[model samples]
Target: MSGINWNECSVDFGEASYPYYFGEDCLDRIVASMAGYGADRFLVVTDDNVLQLHGEKLLPALARVAPVDVFSRPAGDGAKSLHNLGACLEQAIAAGASRQSVVVAFGGGVPGNLAGVVASLLFRGVRLVHIPTTTVAAMDSVISLKQAINSTHGKNHIGTYRTPEAVYFDAGLLSTLPSKQLRSGLCEATKNCLAIRPQSIAQMRDRLAAGDLASPQTLLWLLEESLEAKCSVMAQDTYEQRAGLILEYGHTVGHAVEMCDQRLRGSDGLSHGEAVMLGMLAAARISNAMGALDDAAVAVHEELARALGVGTEMPGGLLIEDVMDVVRVDNKRGYLTVSGEEAAMVLLGRLGVPLGSHDLPLTAVPLGIVKEAVATLVPDNQ
Candidate 1:
């Protein structure tokens, strides 16, 4: 009940901290908070779709705080690359950005990440704020300070950690999203229940089955569930290089599948949550093969995927080899040293219980086991 109103929370990331303000249709209030930043100008980092759909409302408000220079990118994960990061910084410089300029991440996770890099690099770090318009960004990405883009080899390959000036969200923006886009957050919520807080599983099932995901109440619940699950892990390990690795639940293989599928289908491919849901399935299978996860726990992953609108089918024509090729150099490698045959992965001994040390939940999953689990999800046509 009290959750529906404007709310503030502290995101204390061990080293850096910021406040997050959120509520339904609270654009005016979010903008009011930005005035305190005292920026000379705001460099709005976003994409074509968000700019077309919601920019008129946000850019005008941001301009009221300071003159706004729009640095828009084409929508999709492709926008988060080293090339775009470099281009965004160059454009911000040409736009007269300075230590007084704030890089506002004004769309989904893609633009949020792009802006994080821009803000961190420009003049060796300036102010950054997040005005997340997508559930994936609000529910998942914005919770951590890890900002990165894809390398030629794998996901999140080139990146840095930069805390934001603050983060803001208006759930109202999510109502305009297509059905396909909703899956990303839903999938992440499922991961939270399965990987971090299994007690929320029943509530999540009811929410999904009710299927009113667009309502403000449901959106609030989704955000809260994500925050409870993630903040539980991230509050201590702000960098997410240690115990917070549990938050990556299915991302290891999920990122690989998502990258390969996006190459084939572009934005129409699996949303990040869908791909990660599939990745959880693979992770569960891998765990079961190792005698860690039970059949019942594995079954829950399947149930949540179906309830959350994720099918087990891998992207058609995406070879296991291609997925493995990406997984081979998965960005999580350096966190723990494993041989060439193993991968650093987050697996579960059971729901809400990661397999490794709670301090460092990541372990070296063998490549063969990883490939076999992923193969089980491949579509028959492929």
Candidate 2:
């Protein structure tokens, strides 16, 4: 933890902008930056596992500047429910939190997203700061303005758009993640490369082959790349409902598989990024079948999946029918006009070229094609 160097970048979404500071072995710098915000109190939102692992290292420093109120839920996607969100709001009020208090999101995507919604709802809106500890949060979720929790019927069904005052992370914290957790963010980054910045595919391949996936250099590279890919598309589209939707390249089907698998396995299911990677595999096949993307391009996705150690096959015990059922209610339904039997999806004509209108990066993909693509991943016995 000796080489502590920090780098700063700005995310400008036309009307608003914020700095994203990141580095290695720099938790102290993150705490110091938060202290400068000069808030009445710091409502640090996180989960049990993160609080146990990295909380002690930064909480004392944060407490030195302002009173700290911690609102924690059991660690997992399940925490992003109405019950937990309401409980967090009540606790913040009960702890004397006010408009001047700042909400600090201090963990992975789940906590970060919940905190974003909490910050937006608390006292109309409080300043929000993100100190993401996981690759998924640091590289993907925290970069955008969307904040949401799952509805009983679908993922991210209940949410709003809220930007953070700033985002900070120490790549050192990611070293503590389990292999599956560590690979999660990179998988999302892979989606960015394939969907937005296909030119970076070679660099991604080199890093994966290098086999030092958790090294600070690799993490930093992924973070920078994600920012570039996402921001380029989101700059003019503040709500991510237009061109920014390209970022959802593999998410339509990926999310359905993820939710279905989560029902069966809970937090033990495929990680979000892993599920999205599989989703991209499905998208690739659908695109190929539709005569948009060629088989060679599809092979590139499979090669990256192998290099990243993520299985391109469907998750075990998952039923294709169940996944199709979820896809029917996909969040991107209205993005394009489709019949009841089709789902709106982002399909690519080639590397870096999405197959859709200039304003929207989605097409209505036939449910039959979607089922066929997903079926390829299922075990024959199923």
Candidate 3:
């Protein structure tokens, strides 16, 4: 660890915190730090694609540190499920996992979340670590404490909060990702600009306009901005049921649309962040119709999405009716008092200003409004 040029930082949750070690081509030192935890075994949770692409960078080093057991599912959003959760848990137990075992989430958000759930449940709570390889996990999901898998009905319905022992990121891994995969996380970064950190909007526009989406400098700025936006909101509400929900600006309709499109096209459809970007566009329209958000702000959403390489339209063959069906069962229903005709959402009255009460930037918008806004993304509303 002496020669390791680690860019050490901390993720502060007020009541809880953990070390986030970031560096270029430093997976070896990162693994050394994880080994310092004095664990007898490592349960590496990852998907097939990540395992194939980047496992060598992590797994061999970990094998030298402790006994490594990997529980891998096929790559894609499909792996985040109750079936995988149950199987991963039961298999870890059968494989001699003990309370002293460390659950290493070794991929993007899908595996990071699956590992989080497994680690939270194993031996009634074991030590957990995150080594995020994807931009979404590194810049967005790992910065927070929320860990979840999708329910049969909607998004993130089955999940809980769990703090990680550490988060290790090597930006070099992101270079191998496809252009589409990279843009997926940029969409979430765009949402942060529109929702929480409005002041950074111009900076982001400048960055996108430069067209250096994969440069080392751009990646560093992306990670820095994400930490600032997510950590600033999470300091007060660790559970994300309050002000932290602002982090979910485009997630409501985004999650619903993502789940629906994934069902139709499997892994080839809209990426999670793309759907969220589209959701932000719809949300902008919804707020405009309600006379809260104006037209120029809505245009900004479109411009950002287009510049980030996201389309403003829905996926081909996806139905407004199916997306609406999932929105009805949106997981935010319990947060506020919404009748069957309404859905709970986070909307803005203007840039940098949320429309709801303090503590919870969430309000009840009629399902009809939600439908109309979403329909604008469809190629043919008729």
Candidate 4:
């Protein structure tokens, strides 16, 4: 821990609060901190790739503190299924895990989500800890209490909100990530800038162009900025049901495009952040048509997308209809009342200002207009 730069932050949920610790090259400190939870066992849920890459460095340190049991699966969104959730539960039970067992999520969003459900359900809820490795997990997923697995019909359909006892991360781990994987989290951070903290846009633009994304300074800045942006909203609306709905900025159409692309290309498809970036483009177009967001704002979205190296257009082999089909069942629907031809979405009136009331940061836009916006993403050949 000598070389590690320890930074501590707290998440206040009104009902509960917990600490989040992060630093570079700090696995030792992380393990030591997790041990202080006073658990009889550690149930580590992770993916095989992470296990192979960082497990030896982390698991051994954890085992020294308490009995550790690993429940690992293949990497990707497919692992977030009811089947795998059950498998993780059975594995924990078979390992003789007790009520004092600490469920430590040891991967990115997928494993973090699955572990969250497992912890919430096991023994009527146990202490949960998140040891996120990926930028997406470190900056986005682990910051909130929403825990869930994807349903066959939609993403995060079967879920609950369970806060972790603590969250920890090491920025050093991100150095090994491929460029696309690194950009995935930055893209989510980009959403935060466009919707929640537009002032950070200048810093983000500078970093994106610097082309040294893997440096500890850049990763730490992204994490801290994301924390400030997301926590500012989530602290008031813990479940992300009211004012926090603004966080869903591009997710409405983005999630739809993401699911459709997954159906077409599996894990090889567009990343969650890339899809969200594309969804922002669609949302910008929709906003412009509604005379809420001007063309200049729309162009800014494209500029950021290009700078982030995410696709500015819709993914190949995907049709506008396919994305629309998924959009019809978007989870944000209940946030507002809309006709059958309208979809609930978060639109921007200007940078950092979402176009809706204080209680609900969403609006109902007609399906025809949604289609018109999505049409911009369609490939010329399609």
- Clash count (model 3, backbone only): 0
lDDT (Cα, tens digit) per residue for candidate 1, span 269-294: 88898899999999999999999999
Which candidate gets the maximum lDDT versus the true structure? Answer: 2
As a whole number from 0 to 100, the lDDT of residue 250 in candidate 2 is 92
The local distance difference test score of each candidate is: 0.88, 0.89, 0.88, 0.88
Tens-digit lDDT string for candidate 3 (287-375): 99998999999888888888988788997788888999888998777888989899889898888778886588997899999999988
Question: TM-score of every model?
Answer: 0.97, 0.97, 0.97, 0.96
1-382: candidate 2 lDDT, tens digit per residue = 2265788889998797899998888888888888788899999999999999998898998999999999998777888999999999999999999998999999999999999999999988999999999999999999999999988777888888898999988888876799898889889999999999999999999998898888877887887799899889988997899999998889988988888888888888888999999999999999999999999999999999998898878767998899998888888878789999899999898978898964898998889999999998886665
Q: Report lDDT (Cα) of residue 377, candidate 4.
A: 88
Q: Is candidate 2 or candidate 4 better by lDDT?
A: 2
lDDT score at residue 19, model 1, on the 0-100 scale? 86
Q: Which stretches of candidate 2 lie above 4 Å from their native place?
A: 1-4
Shift in Å, residue 89, candidate 2: 0.5
Off by over 4 Å in 3: 1-4
Prediction 4 TM-score vs. true: 0.96
Over 188-250, each residue of candidate 4 has an lDDT whose tens digit, in order, gives 999999999999999999999999888888887988898898888877788999988888899
Task: Record all residue pairs in model 2 with backbone atoms less than 3 Å apart, i.e. clashing.
Answer: none
